[model samples]
Target chain A: MTIDLFQKTGAFAENKDVARDIRVRDIIPALERHEEVILDFAGVGAATQSFVHALISDLFRQYGNGVLDRVAFRSCSEAVKQIIRIVVDYMQEGMGIDTEDAPEA
Target chain B: MKIHLPNSAFLGNLDSFLRGFDSTHPDHLEITANDQWIAVHPVVLSMIAALGLTVKPGNVRCGPLQARSGHYVVRMGLLKILNIPSSITMVEHEPAGRFIPLTQIRTSSELTSFITEMIPLLHVESEQAKTIGYIVSELVRNVIEHADAEHGAFLCAQYYKKSHSIRIGIADTGVGIKATINKSHEAATDLEAIRLALWPGVTGMTRRDGGTAQNAGAGLFFIKSIASVNRDFFVIYSGSGFYKLLKPSPTRRLRLNADPFGDRHSKRDDLPFWHGTAAGVDITLDQTKEFAVLLEAIGTTYRTALRERKNARYRPPRFL
Candidate 1:
């Protein structure tokens, strides 16, 4: 599988599908390479909570435990981080992951 | 147009209100959840259902609706149905310290236009007006689901010119903050209850047979977090009277680290929960434009909730 990650800077992604595509097309292939996957969203602008949820939820589900732990997010704004935090919590609770075992923002 | 939840003890009152077969149409019928009272106008309910995906000829189908007095939760399951927004608006008003209420049903269609229209009333750019739209959307969405008002819903947007702060109050007469907390745990005083309701996961409704944990709790928690730490203050009234829970004092406002979500310290004090179902929220914003963003986010969230509820009802759980 080929790996290609595109970083876009804007206030918000138009919808969740665009967000999910970015992950499925770009991030997943990169994960196929090594046992670990680290995604760096360092310079992207404001992203919605739902968009982030669509992108990462499947990964979290597939990985079972520590799925997101292998994928890292760096240098996101407080707003972006908050969205990630909410989505992660939703996924964690939905998947029945132990809150203690879940990674923090 | 007004509906009252006469008997807080019975669910039949609410069922009647939802059906729109109100023998007492045009008059207010009070609806109560966990003792919280919300007076929903028949027209408003009709409009909301008509505008959303739950447009069944004579019945109402909402996503997940859990009501206790202070904390009420309704997930909008129709989001996926509504087309993406072509426009948005945000508003900051301090016209008076009193309540100023606006409805999402009216503004959902012309969000961009509404933002532009508010420009003259607010004398701000369309962008800032859009932010007000977001804030209002989130606040109102919270109100519709959580704020229990039997009659008139109170809303206010106060602009403190001196400090460059805008505080918006969305209140209802149903149940106060304290009563919401009592549903989860017993509390001696209103203050303790108000504070406990502010905590995460303190919902009056527990999990139902087909509902998800998303239905467990967390609406007010997000609303308060967005308003209190990020914006300004989030105040509530319940079994007791009105009270304000602000993070940094006015004197030390800027010196305080901007934490949209309150610090753990605020939870240190054991606040009591009030009995009854109604509750309200006050949110502040530094920039008006963020309001529109918030509003769209809220719309999408509720729409999803509505869909989820409809799905659950149709696909009942089947045990082996």
Candidate 2:
């Protein structure tokens, strides 16, 4: 199956609030149509940790593990990406599983 | 004009006490030795409620009083829960110095300059003076970037010659730190966000254009480091929890103390976060040099940002 990828840059690209909402809107639809989706956050600066948590953890819960089988993010700033990784670890820990054991997407 | 309000239940009595004041007779208004502004949480609520009872119910102007131990305790406690900077903090020696309240970003520069000008008043050195500039600017600039509006934030500072420290505060009417975190992160609870944000390398910056993190997860890191090394003071109040880096208990306040620069040294984080969020900082630096005066220059940078017009727009840009 063909998975659609979406890229955003400029204004909203840098908005933590909007980027979060966009992540939800963009990802959920692709879940229904395709088996995987990759979000590119290149050229984006800083994002509030909350925004990353929403995209990485909250969205996963909304869809369920099996529902969002293949998910990936590309080209986020190191700071932005680090927060995402940390938040994901936090969520995984909350679920009582090693993050490495969890499926990506 | 002394009144005792042990609880909010006494708001009516407090109201009567306030009503007793007449500007024409200022001497009669002086607080007596027994007069204590008991800022109990519930009592403060009641005070606000009582004040709300007024017919016109407009602007309420209160104190620019000398920084007292009590004021430090209550304010720090409150700001901690709210998760914003407390515009006022402990000064080492100066007493009864003038306080200027500047709310708009346009005047941030003047505010910084004003502090820089006050450096000689306290007798700090050039290097320490630069630190004063950096800390104050970082604190104030963050206010402008995040908590200024959604929270109706306001900024004010106090310079005390006797104590040899300057105290400043920035408050807002937006969501508290807890709310901001909750809104920003679906996984993080308000409380968790509070804890995490304080951790070094944890930042609120986003990947949007306006998303630049004013603080690089490093601002607080550096500030805390400086406070520790120099024996300065630092406190952060976000959402409903208070996190402090000071005196014995580094993570949280086991008990509250009010010596802005007490021997034990205490920093309070009672920034009001009733709005979506509000954040403020209260820092006290040794004022033996010109650093504080130079610190004022940072405000000018913030003021310049205000003039850019880009900041006026409420909504973040939509990248279609």
- lDDT string for model 2 (B1-320, tens) is 22222322121122333333232321222221113434222223222222222212223323332334345332323333322234455553432234332333324444345444544443555454445544554444455455534323344444445655554444443444554444344425444555544433344654121222123232344344445444444545444444444534345443222111322432223322223222323334552223322212222222233223233435787999
Which regions of candidate 2 deviate over 4 angstroms?
A: A1-105, B1-124, B148-152, B160-163, B182-187, B207-215, B248-273, B276-320
Best by lDDT: 1
DockQ-based class of model 2: incorrect
Per-residue lDDT of B320 in model 2: 100
Model 2 chain A TM-score equals 0.67
TM-score of every candidate = 0.41, 0.39
Q: What does the lDDT read for residue B166 in candidate 1?
A: 46
RMSD values for the candidates in order, in angstroms, are 15.2, 16.8
Q: What is the lDDT of residue B123 in candidate 1?
A: 45
**In candidate 1, which residue ranges exceed 4 Å CA deviation?**
A1-81, A90-105, B1-135, B147-154, B158-160, B175-192, B207-213, B226-231, B247-320
